[model samples]
Target chain A: MSLRPLLIPALLLASLIALFGALLLGSTPMEASRVLAALAGMADATDVTVVWQVRLPRALAAFAVGLALGGSGAALQGLLRNPLAEPGVLGVSASASLGATFALYYGFFSVSAWLVPVAAVAGALLATMLIAAAAMRTSSVVTLILIGVGLSSFAGAAMSLLMNLAPNPFSLSDMINWMLGSVANRGFPDIVFAAPFIAAGLTILYAGRRGLTALTLGDEAAAGIGLDLRRQRLLVVAGAGLATGGAVALAGAIGFVGIVAPHIVRPLVDHDPARSLIPSALLAGLILVLADIGVRLLPTEFELKLGVVAALIGAPAFVWIAMQRRTISAEQG
Target chain B: MTDSEQKFELTVEKLCIRAGGSLLVENASLDLRSGELAVLLGPNGAGKTSLLRGILGLAPTATGSVRLQGRAFGEFNPQQRARRLSYLPQRRPLAWPSPVRDVVSLGRYAWGCAPGRLGAEDLGAVNAALAACDLLAMAERSTDTLSGGELARVHCARAFATEAPLLFADEPVASLDPRHRFRIMQLIRDHVSTGAGALVVLHDVSLAARFADRLIWMKEGRITADGPPTQTLTESRMAEIYQVQADINGNHVEITNPLP
Candidate 1:
């Protein structure tokens, strides 16, 4: 049998292995037997505290954030019918980061931790709405992409303005660290705050995946085949918004995972956008967990940030994929 | 007694289509009955495509009413409309390099079946369409690997797989070779012979004269003539519409030269 049928299952197995490896390797390494016993709640108190309190939430947080980005990326690429379409490139992640930064700058997190996530979701939703509206008004794909670029630039400018008027160095540093993105010291409460939005978003994306499949035939033909363009746009925008917002809230602005994971999984799924969703999500989650593990294993004096590590790996893959696409198109021409 | 073939499958009345602040089709009216193959003929800017789009509700209609099978067009939802009328647009856009079988299976979308998970009936329909289009050999190949003519046939197979009662094809034979063009026209003719209706746009006058049961001629957003091919296509009409001298024989049109 071909490798297509075995891909998702293999990714699942890899994810389990990665999660276990993440629990085992940290600043203070522990034995596998002790970690398994601690997971079963029969180990010493120190092992239990370290396993249950410290590593478990951080690992799960990284996986969940990856799931959000990868799934959203696949959906957006299908909707736009563009290989390069992703939350980071389309401005949704940057907008969500701006919202979280706003909350951080204004001391809203001091009042309640939930405010940051809520603000990020709001930012993502607003950006998605603007893009969807522009999509309806024009039939040009380049125009829609340019609008996204404009939105990203505007959000970046607004973020810089907030940083320029910081009240204190402590809050400014907090903003900077959040922007860089890491899962260290993350607890269950952080996961609890972002889980529902992510789940809802992914569920909606799964439900509307058939629309993405129909969209392979282009917009007018898809519409002619009884696929409702308006409804499809709504599902993609709202789903991507909620999921990316939650990821930004949980980890903060992780980029390129969305683009790279889907690109890798597309060929495996035979390039059907509907079938690519779950595999892309699984592969991306595995990638982030592995990246987090790499972060801990490095010999740097200071622990590396997860977002920085992800970009360091993902940016190169992105360039390679772009080059591969150019070569294919040129060959076709 | 009037048979089932006499019943009207589609009717458009006083339709006006507008785009970019200009009227594309103005006060156009036509009716297609079961088992009838109609061809639309026009100059480049004569609004043949616009009329088809206006009737299908794909374009912005300023004023018009369409009825399919005796029911108002607005009464049916998108799925219901798709089951009744299938459209093959001029521009064929395939985003990804999906396999040919997968793309053809998308015709079953209105029936709630995706490409990988097709029911028995859907699979039968897809296989039949592939065979009809002579694409069974390329079923496993990616669409991006196909030539221009092959891609056009793929889109045609996708439309045929739907098996809708009414088919509207916009320049389906534009990119095809002579043999394939005749093959596609014969396919449409055969499809209508099964008590279905088809309205196709064609640029080849000889092909339309041979296959189309009726001809509808449009000029500057208005239809100027509508009838059987022999009566509608004449020397004077050709000169008036195309500004060319032409000789019209039985199922053959020979244009001598453009009028200076």
Candidate 2:
């Protein structure tokens, strides 16, 4: 049999096995047969609750959110034509955090959980508009990147100031949760809240994939291929905003999947930016799910936040990719 | 290459250019007919690049109007204009290693060809473009991994894939070797041989004279001459335009000015 046909299915199988194992094994270990019984709808009440209400939703959230981040990151990097570009680089996540913080600070969540997501979407859109306005005119990608960084820092600092001024425990909790980005305690409603934006973003990106590939050869060539620079940039901005914002609204600040997933998957796809999307989504979901599973596995009396492990993995990877690109740029271009 | 068939016509009137407080090209007007292989010849900083940019609506294009195929340039929608006219800027800087096949397919963006996705026509166009540029062997190779000559061909493939009626390229041969220069010019000529018009800004007058059906010679913000190569590319016109002495021994012109 050709190994090609087995690649995705094999990866999926390995992931499913790992996920199943992680779900069933822990401080309260469930037997494989019992887990299968639960899966097959023959389990008793307690096993059904444990498997369905808690483990399954958490795992699905981890996978779906990871998919959003990974796909968004891949698309963002290609659209920006810089491997270093990420959702955080453009301040989308920070803006979402600020929005969620604002909602909780004002007791919007006390009225409704839906309000928090609305706030996040609004904030993300505003921040995206600001970044696009500031950086759209210049021919310099470095300048655009720097503007994004500056805007992200501004949003982060503002978020910190809001956190410090917080008068209630809800604001503090919301800020912390938003920053750390967890998929815990999520239900189907949370999934519903995020699905539309992520889908829209991914669609916009997928639509522009060919253009992103063309851009890798440079702007003039991309234009020669009939891509209008302004229109393409607009699409990229809207796509990244919708995706990163939706993911952030759902899971908080879940860091690095967008950056790490694309970089890790690019080589496998032969350095073609468009091909990075599918593999990136898979890798991203796999990483987040695994990380989420690890958080449950940790022996700490209090749960270790998912973001801490992700940061540990992502920070080093970011540094390595940055250093690698800088060293290779002189010889490559 | 029929004489009767024509699609896009670029007309510029009283085009003046001043970049960074220096007048580069002044009061240049041109009526570029459709389906013609037009080449701009100029010395360094004689504003060949500016003129091309002016035509593409890239430059500020002070005190002038550029009509694309009879319509005012600004009146057309940006995407609609892009579909009709395409531009390749000078010394393209592609920093990443995108595949050659993927790079050429960018031409479908104005048409909104989505990712992991292409229709039969798109694939056919991509394959045909690669073949036209002789990049079929390196279709899957990383574009950034190629030599300069190869990179130029990949860009040509991209331009060819655009399927626009008018193509504008600035200094398409600046970094190319001699053999590659000939090849690039030939490919560009082939592309223009279709109903599509092509305008290339070049520093090499001999190459322009050899390849282009119509020559545009510019100096100090003006079109000093526009005609056939045999009439306008004489020794005196070369000396006057370049501010130096030159000799045209045959079809080739050599500059014999004192070394600066």
Candidate 3:
């Protein structure tokens, strides 16, 4: 496959290695040989159960959510042509989190375990549809970002109100924990719910790859090149939102992977903004898997939030990017 | 038929375009054909760009119809219309360090080639476009690092890559050096002569007269003078449309006075 098509699989494999490393080498201390042996189908029954049943699915959840968040950010930023744009930053994640909260409050999901992420995806679709409707009016990048921010502020406020009205203190914690975001206890059910949405989002983003490529020349130029700006914008918004919403539902509010991963991987693709998506998705998986491991490896016994870890990692990364951008622009000037 | 034997025409009739609560281009009509390089010349905000946008169907045509190849352009999907017509706006910003080749490949978007791959025709059109604009050497360089003139040429290369039968370029040569400007003018003129139709907007009346086969003098939201460039660049029409006297001698029209 000449490493082009294989790039994703390779990155996935590397991420799998890292995920295994995280599982095998946690603070609990499992032997490396035992870990590899279990993974390689040679471990005893107890080791196999520990490696396969307990930790494997959680690792899978991180990978899936990370890929969605990263890919969603790339697709959104590409559609808006704004580096500052991110799925969580733009409010899709919050909207879906709110959706999950609402779904929980009604006791609707108490009757069914699968309803949580599904409700979150619904919330995500609503937010995405709204953003698309508003952004389609103007082709300006600034206007699109501004509209995203506006929608995000509204969704955030509504989500806060929903938090206030939670049926009980425990429900509030559930809501809070959901917003704080985590991939720790996620199982195959979460993956099944989120995967199809992310897959759909990827398909749309892939389909609009040509338009995104054209848009780098500016909207008029893209139009000149026969790209349907409105249609492409709508598709991207929906795709980015759906995938991102699914992640939010599965992981709560894992932050900055969507933004930082794309920025980090841009250099790998020679800065072709359109081709940055695949690498962004892969790198998101890498960063998240490593971050999840760090959460497990923390000195304290109490589990720290994964979102906190990401913010800690991503905040510095964001600052570095801003500094780099300023230095580059100053040099250019 | 050879490009020389073919004749493509663009017809804009009863066209009206409004923006920001004003008629930027109203009741405008014009014709452009092969063997004719038309220049839409006027002062800034004289509706030159608006008229161009209307013909390209980018602007909201409140009233009017544009015909490309005698087909109702209004009925053509925007992308379908874009396949036959190319446009160069006054300014375009590269938000990323998009490679010059990748930028130009946008012109082949109407071809709808698959991602991570290009077909033979798409590759040919891209290559021909790069060759046409003389941008082959720097095709691998990032456009964001290009100088203003180089970026202009890169955009020109992109527009040409569309391989459209009609071209609407708005101040395309504005930031170019004299050498590049002259070369670009010659390139536009040659392409027009080779069967494709073009309307190039210009502020330099003399260049319009010297290079364009026809003149479209847009003034205050309308075509004030439209005819052969030599016939239209006269003192009265220039004074009427531009509100300044023009010194017209044979094919030359000077907007600036000589040293006393």
DockQ of all candidates, in order?
0.82, 0.50, 0.66
Q: Report residue A238 deviation for candidate 2 (angstroms).
A: 2.1
* CA error at residue B245 for candidate 1, angstroms: 2.7
C-alpha positional error of residue A164 in candidate 3 after TM-score superposition, expressed in Å: 3.2
Q: Chain A only: list TM-scores of all candidates.
A: 0.93, 0.89, 0.86
lDDT of 1 by residue, B1-260 (tens): 11234455688999998888888999999998878899999889999988887887777555788998779886888887787788888777888999999999998888788989899989998998898888999999999889877888788889888878788999999968998899889878877776668999999999999999999999999999999998999998888788889999988899999998
Model 1 lDDT per residue over A1-333, tens place: 187888989999999999999999998898899999999999999999999999999999999999999999999889888777778767888899899888866788888988988889989888887877876787565687688789888887898788778553455545555566788889999999989889989999999999999999988889888898889999999999999999989998788899999999998888999999999988989999999999989999988899999889887887787788789868977
Rate residue B181 of model 1 by lDDT: 91
The CA lDDT at A318 in model 3 is 64
> What TM-score fits each model?
0.95, 0.86, 0.90
Clash pairs, candidate 2, are: A181-A253, A225-B107, B25-B221, B26-B221, B26-B222
Arranged by TM-score, best first: 1, 3, 2
lDDT of 2 at B54: 65
Q: Which segments of candidate 3 are over 4 A away from where they belong?
A: A1-6, A27-49, A111-115, A129-157, A168-176, A326-333, B1-6, B114-116, B256-260
Tens digits of lDDT, candidate 2, B1-260: 22226566778887777778777668888876656888988778788877776666656535577787678886766556666777778868775676677767766566666423668877787788899999999988877678989989887887777677778888888878999999999999988777778888888888988998888888776788998887788887877787767788656978888434
B-chain TM-scores per prediction: 0.93, 0.91, 0.91
- State residue B155's C-alpha deviation in candidate 1, in Å: 1.0
